[model samples]
Target: MAAGIMLFEQKGFSETSIQDIVDMLGVTKGTFYYYFKSKEELLMDIHLRYIEALLENQKRIIEDSTKTIKEKVFEIVYMLIHNIEKQGRQARIFFREMKHLNEDHLKKIVEKRDLFRYNLQLLIEEGMRNGEFRDDLPPSIATLTVLGAANWSYQWFQPDGKLSDFEVAKHMVSILLEGIEKK
Candidate 1:
C-alpha cells in the first residue's frame, strides 16, 4: 500500500499502473494481487486509513473535557499539523490521489471528510457558545478557515524543517483567533 501510494503521488493515478507498483515493490504480480484486487482498491485502502486516523485524532482532541474550547481548538490544529509531519507521504497521497477513487469510493471518502469538517464546525460553535470565539462570525466559516489553514499546510510544511509542527500550530491558532498586529 505504501509503495502504491508513493507511486500514485509521484505519478498520477491514471499514469500509475499495477506493473509500476509491483516493479517498485520488487514483487510478483501475484503478490500484489493477493493483497489488493486492483490498484484502485489499494488507493481506497490508503484513503480509508488516512481518514480514520485523522478522525480518531480529532475525536480525542474534542473528548478531552479538561481543556477549554479555545484550548481544544488549538490542540486540534496542532494535532492536524502533527499528523502531516508524522504522515506527510500518506497525507499527500490522501489529498492528491482522492480523485482516482470511483464514485462509490469517492462518496464514502467525501462523507468522512465532511464528518471531519462537521466536527470542526461543532468546535467553533462550542467556542461561540462559551464566549471564547466571536459569535458575529459564522461557525462554519471560522471552522473552514481553521481547517483550511491546517489542512493546506501540507503544501509547504516539511516535517524536518526549521519550524516544528507545534510552532506552526501555535501560529495558526493565533491567526485564527487574534489576527495580526500588536495589541
Candidate 2:
C-alpha cells in the first residue's frame, strides 16, 4: 500500500502501473496480485483508509461535550490542515484520484464523504441554533464555505514552511469567522 501510494502520488493513479508499485517494494507480480486483485483496488484501499481516518477524527472532535460549537469548528479545520500536512501523499491521493474509482467504489467513497460533510453541517446548524454564529446565512452554505476553504489549502500548504498547521488553521478560522477587511 505504501509503495502504491508513493507511486500514485509521484506518477498519478492512471499512469502508475502495477509493476511500478511492485518494483518499488522489491516484490514480484505474484506477490502484488496475491494481496490485491487489481491496481484500482489498491488505490481504493488507500482512499478508504485516508477518508475513514478523517471521519473518525471528525467524530471525536464533534463529540467533545466541553467544546463549544465555535471551538469544535476550529478543531475540525485544524484537524484537516494537520492531517494534510502529516499525510500529504494520502491527502493528495484522496482529493485527486477519487474520480478514477469505479462506479461501485466511487459510490461507497461518496457515501463516506457525504457523511463527513453532513457532520460538519450539523455542527454549523447547532451553532446557529445556539446563537453562536450569525443566523442570517444558511447552515449548509456556511459549512461548505468552511470546508472548501480548508480543503483547498492542501494544494499549496507547506508542512516545512515557517508556519505550523496550527498557525495556518487559526488564521483560516479567523478569516472564516471574521472578514478580511478591518473590523
Candidate 3:
C-alpha cells in the first residue's frame, strides 16, 4: 500500500498497475491478490484508513471536556496538518486519486468525508451557541472555510520548513478567528 501511494502520487492511479506495486515491494502478484481483490480495492482500503484515522482523532478531540471550543477547533486543524506532514504521499493520493474509486467505494468514502465535515460544522455551531464564535456566519460556511484552508496545506506545507505543523496550524486558526482586518 505504501508503494501504491507513492506510485499513485508520482504516476497517477490510472498509470499505476498491480505489477508496478508488486515490483516495488518485491512481492508476488499472489501476495497482492491475497490482500486486495483489485487495485481499486487497495485504493479503497487506503482511503478508509486515512479517513478513519481522522474520524477517530476528531472523536477524541470533540469528546475532550477539558478543552474549549476554540481549542478544539485548533486541535482539529492541527491534527489535519500534522497528518499531512506525516503521511504526505498518502494524503496526496487520497485527495487526488479518489476519482479512480468505483461507485460503491466512492459513495462510502464520500459518506465518511461528509461525516467529518458535518461533525466540524456541528462543532462550529456549538461555538456559536456558547458565544465562543460569532453567530453571524453560517456554521456550514465557517466549517468549509476552516477545512479549505487546512486541506490546501498539503500542496505546499513542508515539515522541514520554517514553521512547524503546530505553528502553522496556530497561525491558521488565528487568522480564521481574528481575520486580517485592522483592529
Kindly indicate the candidate among 1 and 2 with the higher lDDT. 2
Model 1 TM: 0.95
Worst lDDT run of 10 residues, candidate 1, spans: 4-13
| Cα lDDT of model 2 by residue, 75-113, tens digit | 999999999999999999999999999999999999999
Q: Please tell me which predicted candidate would have the highest TM-score against the true structure.
A: 3
Model 3, span 41-68: residue lDDT tens: 9999999999999999999999999999
List residue ranges in candidate 2 displaced over 4 A.
none
lDDT (0-100) at residue 2 of candidate 1? 80
Choose the strongest candidate by lDDT. Answer: 3
RMSD of 2: 0.8
Q: Write the per-residue lDDT of candidate 1 for residues 1-183, one digit (tens) a residue.
A: 888877887887889999999999799999998999888899999999999988998899899989899898898899888998888888888888788899999999999999999998998898899888889987888888898999999899988888899998998899888998788
Prediction 3 TM-score vs. true:
0.98
lDDT of each: 0.89, 0.93, 0.96
Give the runs in model 1 whose Cα sits over 4 Å from its true position.
Answer: none
**TM-score of each prediction:** 0.95, 0.97, 0.98
Judging by lDDT, tell me the better candidate of 2 and 3: 3
